[model samples]
Target: MRKLLGACSLDVFARVDPLELIAPAPQGAALALYVNLLAESLHAAGRTARAQANGNSYGETVGELALGLAFELGARQGDWDAFCTALAAEHARAPAFWRQAGGEALLRKKVNDMFAVLRDKVDADNYQVACGRPCSPNRLYAYRMLDTAYGEIARLFAGWREHTAQVGAILGRPVDFSVPIEVRQLQSVAACRPEWIMRWSESLERFGGAPGPLHTKSKRFESLKNSPDKIADMLREIAEYEAISSNRDSGWLHDQDTAGAWIEDYWRVLDESAHGATPGPDLILEARTEELDAPMVEVAQAAPVADDDPLDAVRAQAVSLPPGFLSAARATQDPGSWAGRMLEDDSLPVRLAVYLKLLGAEDDCYPDAWRDPSTGALPNMQQLAALDAVSLPTLRKRRDAAIARLEAAPRTGG
Candidate 1:
């Protein structure tokens, strides 16, 4: 009883530390919490501007790092929807912060911070591969996981429905009931409903499904499956897919020329990684070719430059020039306005990456920067909650502004 009291006291003590609220004791989710803990590290590095000028990309890169780690971890472990919603919320915010600092500062910060998360995430991915899950562990998200779990429950219900026929046939009685409650009334099956699984997961005390151990009186639903492995696999699957769903690397980025000047080595490095294997035989190559051949829509430009198309100029600027406000501005055919030049650039992804680079990946990257002295701390959930304090939806406003500015630019501005 003395030992039990001590352990309970220890848990309570751990909870009182605000830092532990994010990380938990002994690191249940170190990589995850560290993604946030980074602000503390960067705060240690000095002011955001100073840290950014060196290309720390601390905030943006940390998001990416967390994504890769979360993807792998979620794929291996637990409930996914809550995990992914948390990530989607994180990623959607950083690029705008990076963009405002200008590209040079953004690059410096990213270069500064990527080492730790990459190592751990890659390790997680390697483990996932070795484990031989039918899909990589890092591939699912919260909603999809819930969907899968729901499907499994439905199937189990169907099987139970079928099983009743066998039971009735043996017992010389009619079998009827959706979740086997009748059996529970006469026996000890408890008639646990699968719906309860999701209900339990959504509760706040459970951390959106990161509940304590399943084999407990409060979590009596575990009896429904009878096999511990079944629940373990389902829970682990939630974690895996959540990890994968948050990764930013999907899409046609493997395509050459689709990427801006900085990525000219796409083909070369891909070949090198494959030990000089011919590119023609690659499926990735074929898919890229197909995508590139699809109709290309030309985004209108803002101003005149020596090159009729400022897209090439932007490419040159990215490859040969250092990233900064003027470098990106000079790349544009037009130098008139900030976002206008981005729309004027021919490569859409580069234009977007540049925005993401500058803005720090969130829609509200430029929100009321004037408010407060600026901690440059990545906004906590509390700070972000304050973002809704602004009357207009940020994405709607930015999109309106970008399109308005792009359309208003003179054709010759290109």
Candidate 2:
């Protein structure tokens, strides 16, 4: 069945458009395209891995590539069973054609052509997601062209002695027998200059007998010809992402080991609290206040609340706030303090909500009166939202705004 599927020409299955491939089609051509693309990509990846001398086996490389492609397709289509069913249907078509000589290589070439078109569709969608901007397959193709140009230029720079005239043209200076400093310093894509790129593009026809991407008659990169700034920005973006991806790969093992390590700490803390091994919630260290250069002001303490306040009755019946909770909590605030002054316009519940977000509900600095009696911690967002007579989203927006204000405020002493 696998041989029969491999033997079938991809053109028969490639007639379906990319947009239709994401949805169920009666012809089941999408499944054939996906399967063939996966197979070809694995083969290509395995060959590249071996050439690079990366110490990875072809089986290991293909296995990893297959898993990655499966995840990408699954995320896009949300149905693997359909692909399987379509595979079975494809195996049963054109049995005579399946036995024809040279069908496998022809099928591989056709499959590559189909994905060459479809790859832009997938990458364009991903570009929008990553950048929050619209992009076209044509633009993706342009990026590839620019990347290729960079690679070629780097190759010329590496062998500056052999390609002295071309390297000099790219550098806008004459080259000598001695090793050039630029060649030694050109370590990564980020260091490749816009002028070097432009000069290389302009000089390619003279040395290589083929016009560079920007210099070609093709209008694909026409707008980028005179715009070195745009070219520089794109080159920087490529370099930045390459560095980030390299870092992620380097840290993969450490990340995997530490991923779930936090759960153990969480359980240990809960167990200690239940066994009464932890200190009382009120036994918190003194607040650390930075001394500003300016003179401090003395703010008056809030007046005590009467025992019969309506809020006290509501709290007692509902969430169990301690007596004089509001008054006690407010008395601790210094109106002259930076955070206090910034959040002064917000209601008490909103202020508490900000603390709940920035500091967790059980921060040691929170006074006992500020905590819910049952939970021995600050009230949750929902509870605080109810106290403020607002919806949870409104409370969240206000909380975020308040935090933003605090973040933007200038700091005094360290």
Candidate 3:
């Protein structure tokens, strides 16, 4: 793991103000700095990984970091073309800065600042989406600070003999000639006591002549200053994720094959199915319909059927649907709408299913009747597939085809 700081220097702690860090950058240059810094970091990490005789841990770390930042960037909803144009503008403004001495570190810091803010924004949005709760960016920064504090404390604990006074202050005890049992027993951040964290924050002023994050006179962590329980919860969350990530990294399946091995499996399955080793190209199974209670809708076929046709009854028996599905579909239909007219040949349920796939399960435009009663959202792909009496893959193919048609369709009016 890379240390946040080279040594335990609390005084030199970087402030977590994204606005201030980005204030110096030109209006359109932030994204450019982020991209260049990421490329540079990845290149450096690659070289370091190659130079190391033991393992590629450095490269792995950098790759994971880049992946995370990329995810945040992707989650953002904006004009990407504007961002690209802004990046070009920034380069034009700083042609000399790109080749100047010490410019690399400055640019890297700017990139870090951009990501720091972006991470909090992305996480805040995710938290809202997942939990239906509000999470401020400052709160996320506090969580980061707490995690950093735990890491620093862990580092200090590992070398207690050299930093006896600091460690003793953190433990709220005097240093003696004998080794402290707390230092010996502390194996991970999970084992670190809540009281130890409070004490560490309190003791920072005595040693470093500066207040710690929690003890600082700032409103950023004000809510966390007095709540050790909250701090403990945050620390535990960090430890839990660390443990989970570490376990996943060392899993046996990771060594089974290269990342592209799944492509081979995909092709093999397709080949087998094509050769008639599997039941059908559609992979539909009648047994899967047993779980549903209502008859399925045949959306793929648009041929008109007689009201009392015997074939209709036989087709209805092939698949099942949830109770009241047909009524809900009927209630939500709008024949004059663009979607309704375009998909007029398909049943209302199938039209809703396509809309559900295109626009997510929950959308402002979706009628309450279209939502699954159990979830208060649109039915999932499996449920939609079951409604149509087709396999999941078949539903996906149909949905994608519908999307393609919509994209190709010409617009009439503004």
Q: Number of the top candidate by TM-score?
A: 2
lDDT of 1 by residue, 14-132 (tens): 33332233233443353334322332232233332433242211233322222223223322322223333333343356533323445334333332233223333343444344344
lDDT of 2: 0.55
As a TM-score, model 2 comes out at: 0.46
Superior candidate under TM-score, 1 versus 2: 2
Model 2: worst 10 consecutive residues (lDDT sum): 286-295
Error of 2 at 291 (Å): 47
Per-residue lDDT tens digits for candidate 3, residues 293-368, read 1112212322223324232222222222234455545644666444455567775546666665444466544555
User: What ranges in model 2 sit over 4 Å off?
Assistant: 1-110, 121-136, 249-259, 264-414
Per-prediction CA RMSD (Å) = 21.4, 19.1, 18.8
Clash totals for all candidate models: 50, 0, 2
Scored against the true structure, residue 50 in model 2 reaches a CA lDDT of 33
* Residue pairs clashing, model 3: 294-320, 294-321
Please report, as a residue range, the 10-residue window in candidate 1 with the lowest summed lDDT: 384-393
Structural similarity to truth (TM-score) of each candidate: 0.21, 0.46, 0.44
